[model samples]
Target: MIVRPALCTIVLTLVTVAVHAKTPVATGTGGAVATISEQASQSALAILDRGGNAIDAAVAAAATLGVTDPFSCGIGGGGFMVVYLAKEKRVITIDHRETAPASFTPSSFTANGKELDFDTTVASGLSVGVPGTVRGWHEALQRYGTMSFAQVLAPAIRVAGDGFTVNDNFTRMVTENTAKFSRFPATAALYLEDGKAIPAGTLLRNPDMAKAYRALATGGVRAFYEGPLAQAIVDAVNRPATKAGSAVMGGAMTLADLANYEARLRPAVRTTYRGYELYGMPLPGSGGVAVGEALNILEGFELGKLPRAQAEHLYLEASRLAFADRNAYLADPEYVEAPVAGLLSKDYAAKRRALIDGRKAPTASVAAGDPYAFQRDASVPLRPLPAKGKLLREGAHTTHLTVADKEGNIVAYTFTIESWGGSGIVVPGYGFLLNNELTDFDFTGPHPNVPEAGKRPRSSMAPTIALRDGKPAFTVGSPGGATIITTVLQTIVNHVDFGMPMDDAIAAPRLSQRNGATTDVEPGFAGTAQAHALARYGHRWSSAPEEIGAANAIVFNPDGTVTAVSERRRHGIGSALVQNKAH
Candidate 1:
């Protein structure tokens, strides 16, 4: 492996620190622990101390995420988790991805037989998908946790009822995205008051959400999907205020959709690269396949021995190959031929890697080899949409949590409300944010991602775990919409290939190959010289701040200590419990 003596030594030194901000934390070599939002992390750690396992800790953290990080993720949204079982040496994938409502159709967002503007289609009820967060958490807990539902959810209830001080990040996001919040009354009521965004340290409370969590704790997953909460959701969606105006399409979510929503347990897509086995979420998400494809292509090149420029070339080229395939053939496998296996194959990546020239970056439309040429005929055509400037949703706020217990069990989970505070649509009695995830799909028709009855929308959330010799080695994930996969991939490279410590790996300057050739260099690295160096390769650098993605990770040391790292770009922090006696 390519290693810098001083850099590697520094990484090792940081990993040895008993405590550091934004780094992962652990206690006993094999004791239970959890990492998530600062508020939720404490709660999850409490669960672990109370005899809970990784699964129990995850549930606790997920519930707290619904409360504290509601702007980005909550029970109203859907997500996935990758769970590693120590005893079985098996990695299981939980697909709680949001599905299209029963009333949703290909033309749901069209008016006068033409596609509506992205804002109109994305914000209204018509944009909501069947939420899966509640069901998904319940499934993971029931199958793997030692604690009961009430125990896991109690912390979230307490947080919502007692309230917590709004952090700086929350305040800044609310101020910046106030316009979108003002458009919806319920949303504005929760986040904004008197026409001004709530300042930091403001005591934010949602007793209604507390009540809903109480019901969930008492009634289990069914309580939310089939019980009183479900009825409230129906009522909220049917309310006149919830309907889309004359300028946009509206929706009514049937009770049947909620009742029938089932979170599936599938096999994680695992691929071997340079002796390490990488595990990531499968189809409904293009993340795993895309990450694998990019890594595979880079594997053909001797990046471990290359200088910075050559390494950048390989990174950029591989990213191009992966992104091209993602746009072309990746989708929900149930609805289309995704070519999951073929796309990640070594042979295919080798051929695609051969197209890269070490000297220059190619244009955006440059074609990469079709790795799945054999099944090209079976691939479903992606629905077409009008050429609009890049559209990003408000409340891009989301959180990621990573945990690895002493038993070798690892959990990488991501949850989101799919916009800041999720359309600001909180059911009067429900007390939680409702997801705008349906906006993730193209509202226009003739695309593979077009809304359809019971179809799951394509998601960019990729919660992942990595294993070495059948044991938990790394657990990590991020909250950057389409940038999730690229961020996770870069972190893994920083940890495994470059041997960077958890903190530096997460904090290092990073770039994403997801949307065109976006180079998100950190502030100091974007100097005139670096800009000129990038320009030589035809790279047009945008002045966008490198707040690309927020990531959290934990590395399991063979000696029993756990190293955790949280992203510095946003207000994320990482902590661990080390065994002082042992050290």
Candidate 2:
């Protein structure tokens, strides 16, 4: 069913039933699902209503998002998923992050030992990686979901077949990325109309995507990873559209690469913050370690009593310290020895915390701290690699979702295609984009994150779930590449310390420090008295009026109900299941 005739102009505003200062405007009594698109959230809730568990609902929502919000995510991309299964009283962390091709090397994009053109590399097929989203979803459904893969993909198939109305943001993105989209014939044929990009409000349908989903549903994951779909991916990625006679424009990905991809369930990076237990992904991706380390540093401060400026300053310092390690030590653990425990230890954070001078502006100079300095083995073989090149900034291009069921099952999922439009290469017969994930690796550096054959590229996709007293407290995550860590961090702090409601905490003004002296904050956040106070402490704000990351969350209320909240700063949606009194 078309939940709303057109989602672009129709903002999803749930009725506010605020009974307490801590109550959110978007609340429900049984379960809740939040995503950047309302249509997807509605699909997830419908799945819950259809007897699906939290994992099932999450799979439904995520699959639907591939149709409704393809700019940020799709079956072509890969990401991380964290599931809390109440029955087992444990967490399941899945790393479906993309990997470098079998032919990858640190100098894959270098010329004469010098780095290739960044923009050229990003737009070419050289940036493609083996996608894991399909296999990941299949594994999630088989292991945790009650519904079959066919049932979970039903909604997305319907949306792609019946068509959904485009929103303003979708229109704008197409306009901004017109050059790239036009470069690839497949991308141009799929996204354009009459030699021009389609405008918002048009009903867009993708029969090709629907066909792929149908094959996936019937043929199972094999149809995607080992069958014809994999062939299409390999063909599109290898045949780049370079100048008629220029060097080849594609990567060396093979069908074998896609067939070999696995969404492994690894241990969740665990830590405690303000009496709550927090969980995140471990390296290969450093989100969990970084979040854990920053929280450990924050546990020592009384954020509720500090002024906004001091609070910002403290957060800035902690983030700088965490990212210093992130830039240096966090990478594919298969290739580097990340000091996970040492980096997240409270004792280590205290040592790094003491380095912050309240009177001066901090620099990345003290970053990549000696986590091993506080470890049992001071001579740990894993040494920090020097992060070089201009610091990488992942653009605000990703999607996140949080789902909770009445059965106590909860999921936090984040996925991406690297940047907007995602390599602009749609498979010939499939209406989906291929990922530019290989660009995430440094082309010619010896950094821990440098590209290596068959190794997964490190990610900032931190999907986190928090528990208080061993029960679900809140689930949160966002879509701002490097800004994701700080965006999610601030939300947890707001709800845990300042007592802000779920919606407020998610929509609050935010700041992000990615190993730098200047922090970029939400517009108007730095103009306040608190921002000036931070200026006094050398917290120079970025002059560019760029928005930081925006997050979506689901908080479990004390009354046993749950509330879903989306980023009001974004064009998204949230909802909770409530009993219909009329019914």
Candidate 3:
């Protein structure tokens, strides 16, 4: 391991403080802890209290979130679920990510040898993908849950039919996407009122969505992807837009794509960090591998003993290195043969570590490194070409939830519609939106992550769980566009390496370095002592407000309790469910 004495010592100091940090202690006697939205969480806990497993609770909350936070997630989008089955004592990942339409082609986003305007592609129907959320929920429930689909989906069904009171997050997102919503009259009519964004506390109901949920509960996954609902989705996907919208040729979505969509059970990537084993999602999504790579590099330093600012300097360096590889090498494993093993290998991390100079920060963008040295017979690493232009940020428009039941089973899920309001097109009578997941593809490029039929787009949503001493210890995740990997990485380091309590870790100030000279940090960061600490190391910095992520987390206590934290940065709720003795 590459050791620096000063680093280890400072990290030890941080560890001492972390032990005393004031995050509440929760007990399994409370039944379950759901850290995101209470309405959704309470529903999940009720399932567990009624003798359902973690998977059932997760399915319940995930469905409820679609009703409560429509802009960020719903049946219209897709997501990943990482589960630790208590009975099986093993972790597994579900790949419910959206895929490109079968009709999509390489030149779809190009005209006359130039890329089309990204905004145009996003605003048009061409950006919609084959959604996989329903398939994932059905799979999870069938494989691990003990509750009926109707039981798990009941809460969301009621909320959609009865209406939910809008919160700050709901109002804020609607205001921000007014322009996109206005462009599509169907979407404009749902959330916008009197030609203006809906205000907070408005009670909104979607009876159409309730009927859609009823169909799924009655007919299972096939109801959404195989028949009337399926035809409705197709019609919505291929709907005509106004003249201003593109009549793009490759925009037509096929019934086969939707009918054939499958939620595969993929291998969950694993890595050892500070004696704890961290588990995260694998290929088609970059969250797990990138965070693992960054963690491996930082593993060499004694994070808790170092001054916060100095430790942050090391974090920035590690993140920069990992992101370089993420941007260059990561792609759909099925389509692009990503070298997953080599990217997470300790030896490769050591080689990548050599590029970090303690005396200076990286000036220019760091390029991808050759990890093939560690892989045997693996596909050659995809060399990163110069970026055609800066890609637009996907927007912090996703939702994440975690559930730890009394049975010790744990579930971490992250889902998204890709951007604020997604394609801004509702499925007419269904009253739910469709994801602009195609926007996640390279608009026009020869990169490894270019658009391809049936390929899952590279995602930054990191739904993560960790085990210590061979038992589930903590779970955390976030929604921050490209900053997600770093956001999740920092939380793990904050709790595991620096000793912060789970609540404090989730709420801590954050910094992100995406292979650039400037590191972005949240406003009022406490690590100001080392704010300029990396200036001598050649790193420049800037302070921004809530530009990183909103991470929700749960830390399992040795005493059989847990600590839950809903990110205060947004409209989040963290509650430990106490089963009524009467129940």
Candidate 4:
């Protein structure tokens, strides 16, 4: 909440604007919004048009997303928000990441000394964490927003009551999770048509969610964390509303957990990338540290001057090196002695960079680098790295949105319910899915990310804001589980180093290397000459998901105008809108 003295007060503001088409790019002067869903983007634009600040639009859009993109994010889940305050000329972060309940322990995911099946765990109440999205929204509004909670939440309440047209992406996700959703009667009733997937173009409405929003708007944050809603959440988690004959693992979440849940205000992780200052969410999100470390490693090379394939090769290697450290050390800073300062150190990056061979990739797993020696604080002890790093299976489903108001206030937010249809158990009357976020923790450890009482699990949701010469240049973020780091890092590289336009940077194919033996690449990238060239460098490749990340960004142009960009192909092609067209 510290505000530095303002250096630049002139910021692009928003005016009444209209979006004619659901396009992937929008350029204007006043304000801009980009998100995976057209409904969410429009909600944000509407807020900005009404003279709301970026924080207001962001919350409005997030609430709308809960209605339109229910499987991805909602009040049932939690997320990270990175915000740039125009008046203060400062970047701040909100960590509303879900926390393990007091009942959780290191062995919570185990049964009879062995780890439980991952998929089985994901579908059970045991996977649900105390949701933080509601409180996070409250914190944002209280601290920064100029609009009231009732005002920002109005659009989402309308969307919930009026309904929205389900698109192909929505249908596909439902179809993929049919079995999981069928286990719970409430979930089945909402998303399925007599135990079958709901078809595309279907108009879906959740009056219960609308009612829930109305309760929040009337009673404020207290209604959610103290009264009937809190009791319902605890009941759902502890007693699980499942059909008879279905065996579901119930959680131990209590009303106290809900009452005590708080969204923390954390410092934004800052790093310099090619002269631009990048600010992103810090722990308990691993994205900021991991992306910053990778970019720092890549900074030693003149990536723009190198062959495209060569530069990509370096990018992949840097990602691998960065992930190794991230997996070994990064976690909830309150619980783990994370070497954050060392991890972001240029010296540490240079040391890790030396491992990259220009001609070829490493033949074996790249081990985690020792960052303790580079730690600025001499009192911190060195932590031992595990002999074998276990790759926790995090869901590759989430949503991201970027918003900017006329006053130059910008917000980049990434939120999730942990998995598509999350835990597959909706609170019988609440009309939202609880997060399967506990599954994000390591099943067994000796690891920093092992489940613990009241600890937030490490997340890959990276919401970033970039500043150039003391003013905002852009804000960017993406949703793709662990690949989130690579998506964000590569997108920044594409725009800043490769000289791609913001739209092109988001549209370009992606590659993700998480210290694995093989790098996962999108089909578009695999079919290119650069892929072939990289193969010559001993880089092994595998097919990535249909898409790597659904990214959204807003770039501030030099002429006081702004450009909003979204994916043109991935996730049904996101929507980008501007408040007013530049003349």
Write down the TM-score of every candidate. 0.89, 0.92, 0.90, 0.95
Which candidate has the top score in TM-score? 4
> Could you give candidate 1's per-residue lDDT for residues 1-583 as a string of tens digits?
1111221110001122122243344435555343446667767777777778888888888888787777778888888888999899899988998888888788877789886776655556666778899889888988987888899888888988876666667777788667666665556666665656776656677667788889988888899899678877766555514324433335679899999999989899888777788898898877788888888987776666766556765676677667777766656777866667668888788778778877888765445355554334454344233223232332345667876655667788887877666655666656676777887776674566777888887777778787788767777788887778778888777676677876788777766654464555556666666466766777655577547667877777788677656655555454444322144
Kindly give the number of clashing pairs for every candidate.
23, 1, 17, 4
| TM-score between model 2 and native | 0.92
Best by lDDT, which number?
4
Clashes of 4: 4
> What lDDT tens digits, residue by residue, belong to model 3 across residues 1-583?
1111221110000011111111122444545555456667767877887888888988888888787778888899999999998888899999999998888887767789898887767766788889999999989988888887899999888878766666666778889888777776667667776557776656667777888899988998889888888887787778633326524322688789889999989999999998899999998889999999999999888888887767878888999888888887787888876777888999999998888876567668777877776766534655435343333356568888888777778899999887877787777667788888887877667777788878788888889999999998889998877788888998888888888887778777777888765777776653565555656566666645455666777777787666666665544334444443211
State the weakest 10-residue window (summed lDDT) of model 1.
Answer: 6-15
Between candidates 2 and 4, name the one with more favorable TM-score: 4
- Residue 30 lDDT (model 1): 52
Off by over 4 Å in 4: 1-21, 543-545
Q: Model 4, residue 556: what's the lDDT?
A: 95
lDDT per residue for candidate 2 within 222-305, as digits (tens), equals 999887888888988898653234453778889889888888889898999989999887777678888889989988889889
Better of 2 and 3 by lDDT: 2
In model 1, the Cα lDDT at residue 357 comes to: 76
Pairs that collide, model 4: 12-406, 13-30, 13-406, 14-406
